[model samples]
Target: MGERVLVAHQPAYWPWCGYFSRLLDVDELVLLDHVQFSERGWQHRNTVADRYGRPVRLTVPVRRDFGQRLTEVRIAEPDFRERHWRTLSETYRRAPHFNRFADRLQELYAQSWTHLVDLNEAVTRLILDALDLKVTLVRTSGAPPSGTKTAALVDLCRRHQADVLRVGTGAGAYLDAGLLERAGIRIEVAAYAPTPYGRARSRPAGLSVLDLLMHEGPRARAVLMAGARTAPFTSTPREVHA
Candidate 1:
């Protein structure tokens, strides 16, 4: 088996390129769902294209109750699923290879999910399954208690006996990666670069990962794997299609 790696992150919305981009660098992907749900988090918000060339935010209503845990907090948007699907479809319909993967994208958004963990897992599965990756997907909530947020991830890594911990560039800001390194696990941070992929709709460059995935199709996986060839890491906050 390949080296085991742990990826712990907050719940993110659909179309997020950075999260999907990180999956290419790890053997196991663990979503940190046990953390508190930030109000303005990427969990319920993401960008989609309008007439403008940049990506704009679309928000979904999640319950304010944090005690119920992420997997239990209901996403209260009545027509949010349909709305997101139509909006993405309309915007990406003109993409270079949009038609080829449109039906699959539609099917992905159409599925119903009850928990936040399931939602994230389902979306991740859709993207990777399309690319035919065999990485194991696990949830933080499902694992044995790991103490605090950062330590929980570390404990998770220890439990899984991972050889490495794959983290986002931003993780160094708060996570004590040295602890894992001290435990004999290699720590690698992944940086994501948004490449320009043109669609027939004429949106700006690098809207969201979904824009890249839908237009690129089978090549999307290769594109993600090749992320290392770009800049060392991507921290620029820019929007393409909105």
Candidate 2:
């Protein structure tokens, strides 16, 4: 059988190009939604460039709970959708290809989404479609419960029958390669040198994938897939549970 590669990450709000680069490399991408929600994490927000080329964060307000799982977190204000759409429109309307994707993107914002996971998933899927990435997507909440941290990740690999696990560089800090190796899953850590997009004089490093799509249009996928390197795993421990 061919290698069954899996990439898993938290559902991020309008994630950056690196996220898509990682997704595009794998056979299946898993959304780890059953994990705890971190207010300070990328779960509900992402940065983008404004008209002046300054980085601005577009955040989705959510009802804060002491230990809420991402899947359980509800949107604090649905009205933020209109404001976000307006911001995106105003910020990127002059982008060379903004007109191509604006209407479809605006339609996404028009939907009523009460949960953060639902919103993030919808946005992620839309961007994937735009980029023409065909990887299968699965959610952890729908799968059998994986234990925490490395054990959970290993469980996910086992459940999906993955022969290889692709992860972002940030995950190298916490992911235990030995655990995955024991499970017969080889680890490929992605080294993504940020791909520059947009016509801004000084491009921001980690803006949302939308920045690339709006600015580069049909060529966005090529731009995103460029400059990605993968290496065999090594690691230290850190706080990224997923």
Give Cα-based local distance difference scores for all models. 0.65, 0.83
Candidate 2, which segments miss by more than 4 Å at Cα?
A: 236-242
Model 2 TM-score, all chains together: 0.93
Tens digit per residue, CA lDDT, model 2, 112-162: 999999999899889888988887778888764557888888888888888
Q: Which pairs of residues collide in model 2?
A: 173-236
Candidate 1 to native Cα RMSD, angstroms: 5.0
- Native-vs-model 1 lDDT? 0.65
Query: Deviation in angstroms for 57 in model 2?
Result: 0.9
Candidate 1 segments exceeding 4 Å error: 50-52, 66-68, 199-206, 229-242
Error of 1 at 152 (Å): 1.6
Clashing pairs in 1: 49-242, 50-242, 54-241, 54-242, 55-241, 55-242, 94-200, 95-199
